[model samples]
Target: MQFFVWAAWLITIANYWFGTKQWDGADFGVIFSTMGISSLFMPTITGIIADKWINAEKLYAILHILYAATMFYLPQVDNPHTFFWVILVAMCFYMPTIALSNSISYTTLKNGNFDVVKNFPPIRVWGTVGFIAAMWITNLTGSKASANQFYIAGVSALFLGIYSFTLPACKPQNLISEKKTFAQKLGLESFKLFADYKMALFFIFSMFLGAALQLTNAYGDVFLDEFKLFPVFAESFVIKYSTIILSISQISETLFILAIPFFLKRFGIKWVIAIAMFAWVLRFGLFAFGDPSANLWMIITSCIVYGMAFDFFNISGSLFVETSTTPKIRSSAQGLFMMMTNGFGAVFGSLISGWMISKYFTTYYTNIGSLSKYVNSEADNAHLLNFLKNKGITVLQNGDLSRALDVKDWHNIWLAFTIYVLVIAIVFVVIFKHKHTRAEVEAINHL
Candidate 1:
């Protein structure tokens, strides 16, 4: 339920804005940044509320209900500016629920005398299943580029918000009693984890890596959908089923989530995170070269690698925080993790990428047959190309400028992302230090 609510609109939103609404790409980054902006403080604030006053499950349900109400208003927003504020309001209510859900799951499992490390991944895998289901439903229903996607998500969220109340209760630990320090009473001590060098470094890196998490989500579907503009791929299955094809990544997530226990126990959190970083490099590299015809294998392989890239960092990082923090600040610590990855990191990634794509990689092209003699003539062609070049738009070989179809230099865009992730992986391996041990693996069960 948690997964479906967001998935219905999250992945397909680019299509609605770019393809359907024909909005400027320069403004698109801020839309995704809404998630990050809300994540910046909402999670921590809600975490404090859950730890100090409210029941975590009830708080989570309330947030979802509020989020659903906000989502229902999104379809009525006519411009990017208005949509930004609306989505920001929606995300403020939604982002914190992610951490709360994790906390509720951990608390419930521990209360039932279950092994979190062994049991949590299987349960989490079902979230990915729900995500995949939402994507299929959205795509198959032909709502990918319509306001109907928002309606679908709003209804699902409303249902989930109500349903969350019936789940096992996760009552607050009431760690805010008068005997504690004022900081503890206010639930501010979670911020003190940054005083620890190791935890601080871990969070800094998590923020950097978080930037990479949403890049694909922001553009992957539109990237495939844009291929339809090319005559070669106008009727390709990929164009028709871009959402379902992207859902392959979520499907891969399910398989990898189940493998988290073995990987975590064997490779440890540090190594698992390193592996995930490198997987991002590979995922982008594949997308940089992949196409619908003969090179479709690369696209599929990229989707397969997404499983490792996402689960290894996200699920493993959540567990690492769970085992490392004390009961009093457990929920707060989870919220901190979400803040770093989805908050600060996401803000930088989305804003910068949008600006960069608009300034450097956005191109204009039309069908080959649309070219007139002035552009087709060998002598005038160079002059035309030079004009477009001066305006920061490249004219691909054999492309026509008569109709001026706005497109992207997708190859270079993905290539840039590949290089960025690759550099991060190399630096991380050199500096971030941790050693895997049987004892640390055993400690998870005790936690």
Candidate 2:
């Protein structure tokens, strides 16, 4: 159930935004910003409901069903305006499922006598495997940019929603008896983590790093396909199989998630997270220099590095929260983590990157005013016509001769982002101070 839900969404949505909808950066920014706006409080609000009023599995299942319905209708959206609201509605129902899924999983695993930290990584790695599978399925079917990808996601969500009911029944705790304060009753007790210097710094860095995460997700596919601008590479395998190639990152994730339990034990959470931060530098730097033909290996290597860059922080950071917080406020702590990373970070990155791409990165090619602009020579008109034809664009008839293409300077764009992550890493290493003890991680597993 978890596998299918994640697999469907991450692999196709960006391509749908950049390729099919033909959204500009500003428009795309609005789409991602919705998560921040709604997700800011949705997870916590839902957590309170699930803990007090309803079953976790039931809440999760209903969210998936609503998510499926929203996605099913998403194809009918004709403009970014409709698309934005529809996606927001989907995200509102979808984001809390992340926390709720974890809640259900922990409850199920404990009931089954499986140690969470020791056993959960291996289980969660399958979600990455599922993600890789969906990417390949979409790319092989040539549906990454098609409405069919959303259909695929919707059908999967519908199935997951139904399948969830068969899983363990995670009934409400009705913990209202033990709670004392108004804020704690509302699951806001976890906000006290912000008052601590170390945690405050960690979350602040998480938001910054989350922005870098968003940048890569937002542009990786679009930038790879932008290689089509070069005639020699237009029909090359990279452009043809970009999403498949990008799936290497998710494939690498399965391997890395298995390594996290060891990494947290050996390096402790501090250095393990720092390794991820530096890996982001390599991820973006390699992409800046990579191309389809001679430098394809660079692109592949960048994808491989993405596993470490993404899973390291996400999995390891979650473990950090798991070990640090009491069970009473665990859901709230996790929700806060998601809010910082997915909500604030996503919004900040999307809105800012959209503006950056529109202002500095987007290129407007010379618009041909009249067919006669190239009439001086048959060779020139043939060249222009052939190029547009290759792009599958039609030549305007008669006086409607103006045509232009917008290309992005992907090289500079990625390099600037590489520098951005590199600086965040340096600042993280310098400013955030936490001394690790094995007891911190070991104590919880033994309990």
Q: Which has the greatest lDDT? A: 1
Candidate 2: deviation at residue 351, Å? 1.2
Candidate 1 minimal-lDDT segment of 10 residues? 367-376
Off by over 4 Å in 2: 180-182, 322-331, 366-393, 397-404, 441-447
lDDT of 2 by residue, 183-216 (tens): 7666678889999888888888888888887787
List residue ranges in candidate 1 displaced over 4 A. 51-58, 106-120, 165-197, 319-332, 364-404, 437-439, 444-447
Score each candidate by Cα lDDT: 0.84, 0.79
Using Cα atoms with residue i matched to residue i, what is each candidate's TM-score against the true structure? 0.84, 0.89
How many clashes show up per model?
0, 0
Candidate 2 similarity to native, TM-score: 0.89
